[model samples]
Target: MRFIARFCKEKSEYFEIITIYDEHNEKEEISKEHPSIKTITIKNPAGIWFERKMHDDFGIIFEDAFDNRPLVHQERFPKDIHPLRKEFTQTKIEETPYLPYKYEEIDGDGVFQVAVGPIHAGIIEPGHFQFSQAGENMLHLEVRHFYTHKGIEKMLEGKRLEDAKPIVERISGNESIAYQICYRDIYLQATKQELPLSLQKRHALLLEIERTIHHLTDVGFIPNDAGFGSALSFASKLGEEARRKMKEVTGHRFGFGAVSFENSFIDIVAFNEWLNDLDKDIDFFEDWIMDIPSLWDRFDTTGILSLKQAVKYASVGVVARASGVKIDRRENPFYLKHGFSMANEESGDVGARFKVRLKELKNSIEMMRHFLEEDETVLEVAEICDGEYQSFCESSIGELFMSIDIKDGVIERFFARDPSFMNWQAVHIMMQKDIIADFPLINKSCDLSYAGNDL
Candidate 1:
């Protein structure tokens, strides 16, 4: 195991292998089983750099990089390159696969393969899911994305700090605030700029509000898939209303041009009134969901993920929280911002996650109310600081991480990692024995945004 780790470190690149073991076992004990992972002092051990070589020749700032590790530092990221830091030049040589793709040679009857979209029913985004099933039950499910990939990382080339807002907002329309806040925070960190206190508070409150409504959608959708219509109808209605009212709070719910109450030009009073109305809606959603959980027995302990797998995949947010993996970016030591006691659940299933999200909505609504109740003068507030850094938070699905780099008054580079990249990979393992019909249910339950991931 030690030797493999050494080889991987030397051959640092994307998709390079790393060692993982049972969560209950000691590190030394796991090393004994796989004697090839080399032992060494590892810096920036939490984020991706430890997983690969340094970034391209540009500024790359990872949220998990230790102070002493230049490999993960912004300076090490190569300049004149791309997001993944992969090199691209004018002249290139390419090769094709030796053999064209072919079907699996399974030696059994009633074993079939089903290919579901890069497109699907109901206006969801594109993704290719190939399922190898025995009759109706799945034996293997492969998920391939990038259908909507528009070179977001590439499009960011030389974009000004403010210029990137449109692109950032487009990353995932549903995750507009999640992406916007991350982008702005990074730019601020790199440039040593500070957001208005009102903006900071409002951004946090809005993010939670997004999570609340987004969670409401997932909670309803998953049950709808389980053939429970009543729960779906009510939950979906709650989510729709929550989203509408949330949009009402910010003049543009999607959060375009939303800068700390939008100055004197916008009506702050109207926004507060909307938030007040949404608060009531959330209370009703919680009360109703409490009763609906008793109706579905399958949602209780279904799709259980052990702590080992959760850690291996680096799952975040509700997915990890449900399975006893407790990591929240709001609480991350590197962020150095406001601190809040995070809420979580231990049942490790659909119902339990639903419960946690509901509790979360209650907290978020309170934050919104607080912000709205305060006077607009708070927008002028500020706290200045020095040094460059990255910030992250738990979004609707999992951890959304962002990094910022500033040179003088300009942003050097910005990078982000959506939970879908990691959590989506775990679906193959989770759906190993799940039924075919249950695929959409499980997938929607995660509710990973395709647009956010396409980046």
Candidate 2:
């Protein structure tokens, strides 16, 4: 069962909380206890409960910015109180639960703290990393990131609900289309609208395309870290070609314009041709990587993520799958109807993570081919509508839940939970007992986005 509580303001002294319960009995009990509080019972789409169970442990503890009282949830951390009340301002506070990293002194002779960027030599996003190490061995790594927090949620406030799509698209450039689809689904759900079969097929195809490119770029960096520069170049060329194909269909390299609830610019014949060529190249690339013994030697048994650690941190996506956590949202009946399946690997190491991506890449390609053949027509552009809406999407990375409250076409509240937020902690756990030099390779293997987490 699922439970969601949304805080509302009735007056300064009184707050009205609306709780949505999946079961009628639970809703009745809550309604009876409060008497004045509002409650609703909903039988949500099947399989949502499992997805929620896998990722329901995250919450922030902080002092209410307006009232100066501590605010936090009482679910996972029962001692905490809910701070997301209507009157509470969303501002930084001295007591906010997540603070900048402070490296504790490790007094051994060789142990010292090594601080790295909120900026770096590469063009990657900014995040501060503090390593407490003894010579080459890393004792502990603390990550501090908020440098790229664009106040994305705050930026959506007061804008027309439909107009917020472009802003949501930028939440993570690599996951742009996934974000759009999740937002679109939420809008449709709240408005009680459903897309036609053709549009649903198009949406799935676009999502797979986004997944393919992201994996390509991410996996490419792994070989680069292992000093296989040629593999990196090959992956980059494949990614570039994929993005070029996206431009042909959506008019944007990252697929910003191609996302919608109504239609798409899919040219099935052209896309199939491109997919065939890319498929051959990818197969060859896989074979080439398999032949490289050094790459395998560097990857195997490195950056191990155990099942116990995965459970403790509530890991998701490839990280969780690598550790034998068998929760894959694509197993839902809805995705099955669209011809997709979950991909998994059981080693819980860098090699497993890398193999998981390759397996998913192949799985996505098969889905793309199925979607293209199943629906052979393109869709013309259609206008978007604005209204109150909520949606749950099983994105390539993991499950994403988005909800927007709109009144008179203006957005009031926008909340989203990304997979990156759940998986970032796994990196810290994986870095343990490994040398500082392997940090880059370990990080590339996980590939959790700093921008996604900061937001």
Candidate 3:
């Protein structure tokens, strides 16, 4: 563990840069192990007129350098280029020579390569998956992405404190609410702001609703991988109904405008009616899981990712929970006060992933009901303004994290880590020892966001 930091003052401009490098390469003693290199870089805006006290602003970036070396900074930067420096204006391009991305080479007579897309069958994002296969069994798989890179982080620069939420929400269309909440919390923390108790409950309710509905879509697709068309159709219908109910309450099928309370609030009577219907649908789905022996046969022991691999890859969210890795942010004291607990399954297979989501779905529903029943008069809102707010609440798919830096009453920088950003690599692990045909089942089990990853 090496920690390096320095402060430079030149011509009345101030700059501070901090870097931590792990010499032993040991995992951080946290609830979960993430595979990406951990790196921190912070840049505070310079100004002499600002009267506010100097505060530490931390920024963490995770990535690997082209040579497979551990790195946390931008992958596109050359060794000599320091783009974050104050003197650097325009981005210099083509300084680093192009190098073709390497893929796993399979040596044999029968082995062959199959290229699957920058386009796909579903209305999905573009990304290529190269598979090395011997007949039907896959020897290696490489995922190539960044075709849709939108430079989201760059776009955040110079934005007002209140104006960044919409851009953050657009990071992933399916997981919009989670992104919004995470970014909001980070900004609130940096600004020393707080939300009312009623608003907190509302925030949590949106999270659970997002989780339940998204899980319904993911788990429903698992059966489809096994040629169970009816199951997929049923799950999609229920999931769509859940979305419609959300739109009815939040004015967006994906819960778009719900983040800003000025635009929305949950109606208890209508929400209760919706929940009652949803509960019945869940019961039907549960019964189907129990009755269908083929479903079990397809999912059980399939896409088996060992607990060791889960830790090695730092898998988070549903995949990690299914593998018996207990890393739920909701267990943080903040959410515990709101009644949150970790959920897990030990098998770490497609079946285990499905089971974990089902169990979490139940937990979300229970939490929603409990939140709805809380006393309204006591649920006071907290002021959002310059303080650190770090609390854990669950997202529909997995844990979401954000950190914001504010200085002199202006937004300094914002950083967020989506669960998909780390867990996409888990797909390769899940593919191991499984045939090419099982790709859909294993891939849909994780249901990672390509846009989130590319960002």
Candidate 4:
């Protein structure tokens, strides 16, 4: 079974560590008297981050873990404090003395290191990347994020379930719709309510639109990073059009509040015309770009993530699909009935990732058109119940997983594992032996979200 997430919840006398997998879930109760448990990293490498995060949050020690370094807490961030403990409810805390983060070092005759950004020149979010290089070739890359960590999960604790929607929607700007859909799914599951087919199609329509816009942006940026400015200009134009259409259909450009049960007013004639135009423009753009040998030269065989590495690290979304992993949550009958088909490539390189995005964008357009034609229906809200629930959605980037525990109509605990959380771990695998100059191109092709991952 594929590993999903591992998180801890505080209890009066103990802490519960819940490990989620694709097929099953396991919970272990660790007595607060001695908060330690056997680590799962030996069998599931992906558990490293989860276990490390649990340690930082709840002071739960994973016995014999390979890497016990703090995941969320920075150096000198008060080693004695565990924020997620039930008793630590202060909104403010004192900072401890500064201590430098210990990044992995490589030693060799000509080895050198390049440190880039927790702050960058561009408008992108903060992340520190340390590259161990020999000449221009990168031997290894160690990425450190969490600078934008907002303590969103902690804030959700004890909040009314109805008031948590806005916070969830804003977790990732580009993935607002996906986050909203997942939140709604969990709420519905907890309340034992099912959405009608019409509403499901409407939700699917919004999700596909979000996916299309993001894919267009990435495909454009990838080419721009490769020095093809024309692709960026054209893709940006198309992306803007899509965003405008999104705002027309749902009052927000990013569809933040569009995932509700009510039917959205879609102008069918205008929508269909836009879809047709997009279809033709995408085809023309693809043909035009494919003829550029130089563009392919930059993209091909650069920043490769092998199929083995993707599977081993549990990579998701385009990163996994490009590497020949046929794992998409959209394979259900609901989506298949709407003309959805999985898009994949096997090269596991920058070129393959680009192709996968293009294919998925086209597929999303087709699916959206079909979903828009579904009949409209009214949805009824169900009373919220005290229970724990989990849900997953295929976000534009990859699989997004959310879990929430409701107690007396308030959120007791909440956790969301964004696709970026998994895909970020596989980035270094793609960078191995590649020249550092191609970092931007490789990074754009993957397009992992910092906000989503950091949260």
Candidate 5:
């Protein structure tokens, strides 16, 4: 919060924190010694329940912006609230009652619906979408998420920033760096401390490596989903091979280093060496994917999302670029302000996104090759500041926005908005015009990580 507080504005003038938690059923006012902070509680809907209970008082609490206050709608904090609440035992909130059987009725000659996911024979998590269709065309689609909502945001409340790294990383395992990149910037804003100059370069380099790997994994999946699985096999192997070398470099499989505060860590030369090998593997994979005409034929004109909707929904990175919206963080010229050109395609289809990711992977290889050849002094930090600041970055997926509030060198407030949340809606939009059989195919092509959205 401190980082967010400081970064948002002057920490003293504009600091706000709001929180809500379920407790006992009593609607009692808690202590508010800090006049600046406001606390609101409806009631904690938990513990000794009445013989019969209705779901009237159960809902989410809205946070007040001026002061960090928690407003609870429930009459009591449910024992089911935070699984980690100290006084009450923890249990999965999933057991709580929910209305799931609602159905809409219609009288028509030949209306049909296709219920997809929540369980499919794919290496993907669960999601269910009921699409009311008329033969090959779709009338409406209702998406049923929460299949992977682990309440991670709620879990991070009141916890220290360092402790939240693992949680953030786990929020979406595949896009670990996007989360960590936002997480690190927010942490710095909260603490008002800059890391060593060498470390910042190291972070950027490592992040690019992660970006390369993530793109490979997902891009490879597109072909696999299209039954052009061979395009992905070698690419997936190279990606995994890249990860293994990165693990040897950072001592962690996913490149999660001393994240929050500085701590003693592992090798650097090894990272440089592995980066070179990664380039070769990527080149090999790229060549293999290109030779397969089946993949391109299926993907080329499929799932068209135009530029207007892409920006309207704030789509990020390759997804937006594939649709002809050219916005890349490296070109922002704010922080680091490196001279990098954006890779764009006006095709607005699965193939466009594929080409964009492929170009980005190439860019990563070039960027790393340049950085690795630099001397130790070249990447060294000459400037570090002590102040709160807001950081907005574009991830491989989309815009990664974060605010850090720092006070007394500790995080006071931290907030993050990932690109997946913004781009997730676009999937539904693009899928609308696509064929019934092409629905799953379109979704897999624009595979916006639902785990990223759940946060």
Candidate 6:
């Protein structure tokens, strides 16, 4: 069983610990009076973060857990102040005395520590990366995030289904379409409404557009990190064109409000012309990058994540696919009908990841073309029944899982496990034995989202 997510929901007399796997789900009821349960991390290491987050939110103890350290709460946060508890209704709280965080330490004769960011020089989100190194070679890397946690899950409680769409769509700016589609799928499931085939095709097209934009950005940034600025210039040009086309088609550059029950119209002539130009430009870009031996010297075999480690960590998206794991969620008939093909690589290194993104970019372009060739029409909303519903989407990053509980026509509980949440855990594994200088390149290859993960 592949572990997916573990979360907790507060109840009047007890707390429910929900563990979700690929095939099945397990629930454990812990009395609120004594909210302690046995840890599953001994068997499934991926549960480490989940259990710790639950402890921070609901004060549910996972007894004998391998790592019981706080995952969400940082230093100076009050102890025993469970934010997600039903009784804790304050919107503001007082900070406690300074408390030092315990990061894993490595002591050796020449080993020294390098700490980077919770604040960075670039216009990016905050995340701390601590490195134990000996003369530029990284011995260990520990990543600490969640500095921008917005309490989104807690904010969703008691919100009407329609009112939650904007909030969910904005969870990650780059993944707006994916989140919207996933949320719409959950709503459809709860309301027992089947989206028209026409609308589904439109949604798929918008999704592919979003994927292409992000992949193009990554491919460009990867080369830029290697000191190849021309590739970034070319890629930025293409990405801007794609973003403009997105706005033309969906009335939003990021496709924020694109996935809905209403119909969306597209001009086939202009859209097809843009796609054709993009396809040719991408081909040229890929060939140009591949022929640059200097770039390959920096990319090839740098920051390797072995297949064994990938599976052990349950890595997803490009991280898993580049390591030869066939784990994409877009294998359904709809995608296949639209000429979808999974890209794979066995090297598990920077070059392999770059190539995978190139191939996926081409595949997404083709898929969008196929989807646009088909006819589409409008859809209508269905009556929503109050209950639980779950949905998944193959977002640009990887599989995005969302689950929600509806009670009295409003959201009672909402949980989302973004691809970044899974992929970020495996980055430290990739950094092992790599040089500190190449950290920027390897990290750009992964291109994780802090907002999505922090939420």
Highest-scoring model, lDDT? 4
Using Cα atoms with residue i matched to residue i, what is each candidate's TM-score against the true structure? Answer: 0.71, 0.78, 0.78, 0.98, 0.72, 0.98
Candidate 3 TM-score versus the reference: 0.78
**Residue 147 lDDT (model 6):** 95
Ten residues in sequence with the least summed lDDT for candidate 5: 47-56
Residue-wise C-alpha lDDT for candidate 1, range 1-455, written one tens digit per residue: 11111112111232222333212211221121222323232421223332322222222322333332322112323333433432443232233334322423343688888988867997799887888889877888766666675656546644666677777777887777788777666655654556766656667767866777787777677777778777678767767776666666676756655533232333457756666766787677667756764444766665555677666666677777777776776664422334355667776566666666666666666655554434354433233233334666567776776654444534444556677766776667677666787787677766788777656
Per-residue alpha-carbon lDDT of candidate 3 for residues 378-402, written as tens digits (9 for 90 to 100) = 3222544554333233466666655
Candidate 4 clash figure, as a count: 0
lDDT, residue 53, candidate 6 = 92
What does candidate 4's lDDT look like per residue over 207-288, in tens digits? 9889989999998999999999999999999999999989988898988778887885678888999999999999999999
Model 3 regions lying over 4 Å from their true place:
1-66, 69-99, 261-265, 337-341, 373-393, 408-410
Better of 3 and 6 by TM-score: 6
**Model 1's TM-score against the true structure:** 0.71
| Model 1 stretches astray by more than 4 angstroms | 1-110, 259-295, 332-341, 377-389, 406-413
lDDT of 4 at 451: 97
The window of 10 residues in a row where model 6 has the poorest summed lDDT is: 373-382
Error of 3 at 233 (Å): 1.7
Q: CA lDDT of 16 in candidate 2? A: 30
Q: Candidate 5 residues 282-370, lDDT tens each?
A: 78777877787877787777788888767655567678889998777677442334335688999889888888888888887766654
Model 5 lDDT vs. the true structure? 0.57
Per-residue alpha-carbon lDDT of model 6 for 170-242, expressed as tens digits? 9999899999999989989988989988888888889999999999989989999999999999999999999
lDDT of 3: 0.64
For each of the candidates, the C-alpha root-mean-square deviation to the true structure, in angstroms, is 9.1, 7.7, 8.5, 1.1, 9.6, 1.2
